[model samples]
Target chain A: MIQMNPSMRAAGWLLTFAVVVAGAVPWFLWGSSQLIGGLPLWLWWHIGWMIVATAIFAAFTRHGWDRYLGGIDA
Target chain B: MPNPALLSGGLSTAATSVELLVVVGYLLVALLVGLVAYRLTGTDAEDYYLASRSIGTLVLLFTTFATLLSAFTFFAGPNLAYRQGPEWILVMGTMDGILFAILWYLIGYKQWLIGQQHGYVTLPEMLGDRFGSTRLRGLVAGVSLFWLFPYVMLQQMGAGEALVGLTDGAVPYWGGAALITVFMILYVGLAGMRGVAWTDTIQGLFMLGVIWIAVAWVLSAVGGPAVAAAGLDANNPTFLALGSSFYTPQYIISTAVVIAFGVTMFPQINQRFFVAESAAVLKRSFALWPVLVLLLFVPAFLLGTWAAGLGISVPEGANVLPVLLGEYTPGWFAALVIAGAMAAMMSSSDSMLLSGSSYFTRDLYRPFVEPAVTADREGWLARGGVVAFATGTFLTSLTRPGTLIQVGSTAFGGFAQLTLPVMVALYWPNTTRRGMLAGIGGSQLLYLSHVFVPTVPVDIGGTTISLFARTYGGWDVALAGMALGAALTIGVSWVTTAGVDEAAERFAVGAD
Candidate 1:
């Protein structure tokens, strides 16, 4: 029953997908010495998704995700 | 003679005095803030325990963030990075930041709504009222306390190590532990929630500033980030890679899962759910949580990872931060970093102490021992409990059972085992008391067996009762227990149906 704006919901799912794909998989498969910002590529991959996750949450919070979904009575 | 282990290469008497003065000054400021908070808050239990549910966005955000960091992140995190390599950052830094943010939104938003409607302060209080079971409240509190004590001791032990490391054995470990314990008791007992949050905000800023400065200084001093990477690659090529021996796929995933579950179930953190001024405040905090985490963690971990490549010897892993600061930085800078680390410990310590007191006073004492106790009496009892718990942790710190990371992990594992029941109870309407109880109890039994008696075989009538001695590749005992708890809850809830309609109405997930 927890609802968000359709676009926001889609964004949330997209972010989750990104986190799962970028954060979890590459770190295990190709955790090589390829450097990104002085960190391993896989590490940067995870950090990249972390930033994306932050952005998604920021959108959710900003767009009144709970209110959009009718969870906030006020 | 001074202890060789505590002696830093560059520490002088003057540096020691400066470091001590900085640490002491920080503690004094904390006490003053506590006194000021005492004057600001009302004499009632709600005001003292929950800050009257009137916390703004920034204080709530920083308090939660600061409390979450604790001595573990400040001390053990760098040590792990130093010992294991840079992949360790993936375990705690990236994973925890992401996971905890999700949890804060999912759990915290709902809990804040529930508390606002029902006037609840503690998680157990909310759970008990939802289930209409006093025993359930006691059980949750008891479980939390069991895990929380070691965590409290971890902070004290970290403070002790930091002092001893910075002072070069001029201050004994026990002396450091005792000083922190006393200060935490006095401040927490005096200030309540208002004081704790105020101090947390200030301490959080101090920790943030000092870590950024220290990291920049260290990176610049030991050449640029690229140069540091080259040094590490030259000496230990795998340090810059993932799936290294220490960071196998299974190990990294399992550690992340365990830490995530454990961290979300921390009593003090869970209590923060009730103190947010609004749902928006909670949301804003979560929104910024990862950024804050990344800001602090990257530099600290980088410093540690680079230390190994720089050939800076870290004899004791948990002492890495202090030793790095003491030997490499100027006297005042080293002192400032030490004070910041101490701030991290103290900010967390007071919150934990306050939560522990609430658990004891509200959950245990009032229900079982003094059902008719007045609010004024309850406040006094909570303060008294703070003193008692701090003293207990101080005594435990004397043993130096393990490094900050080791002790912290054990506590984290224990708390993680509780997450399943908590989550299910919050969202699932079908979760009966039996199912809930079984979930928590069974998982704990399985977890304890795995951690303490994984291979203990007991023969009764020629039948051995040691079914808990199983191991899985890459799965930490805590994650396994959480999985088992989830299974038990879902399985038991399916066949049975017995919960109050009130519970159903109150806990309808996403049903505002």
Candidate 2:
């Protein structure tokens, strides 16, 4: 199996946790009319989370996900 | 896109000509890309099916994104947003990107690894081998084919509507559908995965660029996003807020789960896992997928939502893109945007056709019908399969079963129900073949009953007895079907894990 360093594995799980918690929970943007950058507060919140999700995934891949990717285990 | 009603003030003769020219020109360019890919890859089965597993980072990323962002994004997304409000964006735009991205990482990464090891070309091949059951492989392929036929038909309908909208009814619906069907068959038949990806890249770029331009133009023309919000606030106040009364919280979350799971099992996308050059290439693509998708979806939905503020009245059940653009913008801009929408439809159609062909050739035909067939003959069969499948879907599309969005959801639901079995097969090593079989079989049985049969009945001596009738309620039937499927999968796997030591070992890692 492709191996990852301990810290990188932790980071990967951490990002996944964040994505699950914030991505699916609608309460994070509940009933807010506030607008940021000419968009609804809820819309901005979702968009902002998307950016964070991308950055976290990008970091995970760069740090250790790449190590686990190249070879087939068999 | 739905069936478009003709515009009252039709385009000028010059505009009509230009519009047709732009779409035809785009189709020609796609054909050229296919020819180039054919020259690069030849007609070998391996090269055609998997691009010889040599796709680069950029091509992989765009091809995946472009194929996923089908006519649903270009047409249904905005149309829904225009009708309901920004909440539609929440459902498809913001949520789908994140959810699908996570799935891409969780499922795609491992599939890529195993695919490289085992030379798996289809999802069923992998699953079948994992359980040491040819029946499992055939069933998986069968389920995918069943759902995919309608999905292909949906794209055909989308293309036809896009053309009709662009030309103001001058180009008949069937004419547009036939044009795309022929082009799709030719390109996919010629170059295989390489051709599809290359053309998808070009179409992907076109889809991205043209939508952003349309959004910018519309935003400027309609006095910006803030002004649009303000107008909605004045005229229709509830639209500017979070939860709508119509889109219940249960509906939102359930649909989100359904869509997220559904997308992961798409046969074309599953095949994409096998085509990644490296794990890193796949990682980069997944990491960047949400952002690329957001770039297209956010603008497209907003423009559709904002069109209302500009006083553009779209015909009920018609695509808003053409109506809004035709009324407000010049003919050239309208033509360009319409062509871009067509790109979205064609890009998706080609990939679906290609995947369907592979499933038939590798998963069903070689194993079931013609085991002694040569590799060259299999390649020819794959091409023939594409033509036959496209023709079937085209005939189905002519019937126009439902609106684009409705048919899309049905297709999505069908695919989504299979996600449970896929995940269990992938991750749960102790999952028995019986469990996998039960999961797939039970889910489909329940789903088909729910969707197709109105009630369960029995007949004895010419007297009919209704045993169970479905009740109309708040719960989405699709969500219920998926839940039942997943529950059966998990429950069966837990109870039936004793006898599959060898299968478990195989599933745990790769074949030794």
Candidate 3:
């Protein structure tokens, strides 16, 4: 069962905000490092994350997700 | 202005006019095919949108390959290889091929399975059904709005570029763009996907033949692939490195995403699956598309490599093929190239127009205009959207630089993000609906920010010279968005929603 109760719904905005902050801090620090020199950190981060991302997507698509979303009895 | 003619190794307006006549002749033939295809395509909306799905493996093979090849293979592919060296060719034709192969393996069966169950016509429909969210369908259509404009712009660019080359000064920017826009609008809107697939067969054949002739001529004029390879090796010796090709790793990985993620998920392909009369037709057709892809590229490689061996200067991007055609071949041959190029542009344009309009009409107007709309009205809406979309793209491109690749990459990057959730949702039993929503929402946020911001490329092959990107977060918002969203969708999805709803019956039976 999904754990998202009303409390979790309240937490949604916090997660979204955290996402923005997570991306922004490094970005602000890197501040156009991408423009002048290229965002080495960001690029490497993406490269590393791409692998993770792809694996997650692969798993999500290839493995059955219906059990989680639709529940067992159905 | 009179269409210029080619004189000696260059285009002369008078000679160009002669070539124009040949092009017009080809256009006449295409018009006949379009009109006839329209009549034969039948009255049902499915027939209009997906070619009655009765198309066999042969038609499916040619149609899919032709759709993939587009004007790019004929124009941009050669030129890209010319500038970047053989490395570029291998990266796109081979590397991209590898990505497509992933599609054959991952998403193909799921597509056929879904088509059988739901009579689905597009991605938005499928997503909407799975999620029980017409709002989701609207969301998808909205996302598509961001994605398709750039694609249409690229198709318009191809048309203008081809006309400029074939007509010399006579077919100026506005005129050429207008002509392609009018023709594509007429064919795509009137006949729908039915016209597109049938015409695609012809376009595919014409371009294939032209590439062969052009490559053969160029090779004989120079030597062969070995000689050509040696010449390029001497110039850009590393042109053979799969890793370092001028084409980007982004393209390869992205293509893999496309191959894996998109093979079954694209709206038109979704529609095509339903149109097939039997599941067997789907399997055979799926197997056949790749072979067509392989056959189309051989001559293109030959043309690029041969041109290099002779020390012929390849034009910057699209101009590479035209410049070579004008230089190495004679007048009649030059005219044939014009016709072939038209096929390339038309095939690409028609398909893009259909896909974009489908999103607008089926996904957007229907939901908003009349929530309880019927199938007949949906067809009309699709046609109307086609007119609006075509006119908008034609008009915008006339005012812009008309670079197909730029528009294409932006669209590819944008739409490609959709691949993440859709692909994952298909097979993952544990994936929550919230996860799909999260992945889509999260990725779009990142993708648009990166694309609009246009930060530095994490330059794939070598160091890219990005003025602002040097230290910025190399703006692959699209790529990262897809990745990040994938993670969040999976992670958050599992943690968030309490559990499965009764709505998930279809996905459970034979999800990817």
Q: Each prediction's interface RMSD?
A: 3.7, 3.8, 13.0
- Model 3's TM-score against the true structure: 0.77
lDDT of 2 at B183: 81
Please provide TM-scores, in order, for all candidate models, with all chains considered together: 0.91, 0.89, 0.77
User: Tens digit of lDDT per residue, candidate 2, span B1-512?
Assistant: 11112221344576687677777776777788888888888566667878999999999988888788787778877887777777776677444677777777668877887777778788998988888778888999999999998888888888888778777777778878888898888877777789889888887887788788887887788778888788777766777678777666765766677777888888988888889897778878877866776777878888887776666787644588888888768887887777767766787888888888888888898789998999878878888888889999999999988888888877888888898778767777677777878888988887767667767677979987553332234455667667777777778878875454335554444321
The DockQ-based CAPRI class assigned to model 3 is incorrect
Worst 10 residues of 1 chain B by lDDT: B1-10
Model 1: per-residue Cα lDDT over B1-512, one tens digit each = 33323433344576676677777777888788889989999988789878999899899988988897777888788888877887777777545677777777667787887787778889888888877778878988998998899999999998888888887777888888887898888888889889999988888887888888888888778777888888888877778877667677777777777778788778888898889887778878887877787777878887788877777776552378888877678877887887777876887999998998899989989998999999878878888888888999899889988888779988888898888888888878778777777888898887877767647667879876654553355457678789889988878878888755337666754534
Please compute and give the TM-score of the first chain of candidate 1 against the native first chain: 0.47
Better of 1 and 2 by TM-score: 1
Error of 1 at B356 (Å): 1.0
Top of the candidates by lDDT: 1
Q: lDDT for each of the candidates? A: 0.79, 0.76, 0.60
Please identify model 1 stretches exceeding 4 Å from their true place. Answer: A1-25, A67-74, B1-12, B454-471, B499-502, B509-512
Error of 3 at B322 (Å): 1.3
Candidate 3, number of clashes? 44
Q: What TM-score does chain B get in every candidate?
A: 0.93, 0.91, 0.86
Query: What DockQ score does model 2 reach against the true complex?
Result: 0.37
**All DockQ scores:** 0.40, 0.37, 0.02
